[model samples]
Target: MSQDLPTTSYALLGLLSFGDDLSGYELKQRADRTLRFYWVSPAMSQVYTELARLTKLGLVRAREDTTAPTRSTRRFQITAAGRRDLQRWLSSATVEFPALKHPIALRLLMGHLAGPETSVTLLEDYLGLLAERRAELQAVRDSLIVDPHSPVDRFRYPRMVADWGLDYYESERAMVVELIRRVAATDT
Candidate 1:
């Protein structure tokens, strides 16, 4: 990888380093299952495109599969240089401050144009969605708990990421509920 590769490139390298060679299709599936929730998840085309670039740069090795005469596919593994680059990127950190582009927050900012009733409804709907997301996270957590050998139990890092997401949803839920009450109070 070059010195100026985008984080998405590095994100793919990180996935490739995770201990198995994956075809472009499997990489996309794994990324959707894991990284899409917290980090950059490339689309299928992006995955194949990046794989091509990485192969050209010698950061990854791709082996062609000729099983089907009609279609040829490649499975990729991170090269030693790729692992080194990812390690260097990881060891040096420039923290990303969490930035939110929440539409409800945007609506609330201009809520005065419509009045507290509009803001209240917006908050209520947003709160419902947050609740639903929290429920889904809870389901994942419960599944992890039931299976003693789950990834979260064995890997401390995955648990930390999951905890941060769960906490974020919980905090947002509480904050929105408070905003709803405060907005409704003006009429009382």
Candidate 2:
């Protein structure tokens, strides 16, 4: 069953596994909050599309919520089948190496064409943007560490991943600083 569905479907299932009966909009918001750090957050339309697909596959169940007093909204939850498939995918799926598609690195590789000044400027700009992203991820990490002493904290793994991401950003920032120095030295 997992073979037929896109990874986004599984991602949504994982979101629902957190025990929240969420509308399509809520799912998208959750994705934006967390997935945007390491994965592509699906667009709102894509969220609805995947939800509908999952529902049709019996992996998700949806019911109309007329309690809004304005209009009805469909709230979705994962079914037993969804949990089984998610666990199967988690345990048995082949893990592939991460693909690096850094636009800054690509541009830096063609630095001779853009000249040293442009290259240095680009790396400098990236440093500021990197800091901004690090701060955002830091906030998320801070939120997750509310009960650090608890071994059974639900967000333990996510907090660890966020820490890993923060470390990666710091490493990348150091490398970019070194590259800027090299580029500036070349300009002399």
**Model 2 misplaced stretches (Cα beyond 4 Å):** 146-152
What is the overall TM-score of model 2 with all chains considered together? 0.92
Estimate, for each residue in 31-97, the C-alpha lDDT of model 2 and write its tens digit: 9888778878899999999999889888899999989979999999999998998898889777868
Candidate 1: segments with Cα more than 4 A from true spot: 66-71, 139-154
Put down candidate 1 lDDT per residue, 1-188, tens digits, no spaces: 37657778889998888778899999998787667657757988999998998888889999887887899888899999989888888888576785556788888889879799888988898888888877766655555443465654443566577778899898988888888888999868
Q: What is the TM-score of each candidate against the true structure?
A: 0.80, 0.92
Inter-residue clash pairs, candidate 2 = none
Worst 10 residues of 1 by lDDT: 146-155
Pairs that collide, model 1: none
**Which candidate's lDDT is highest?**
2
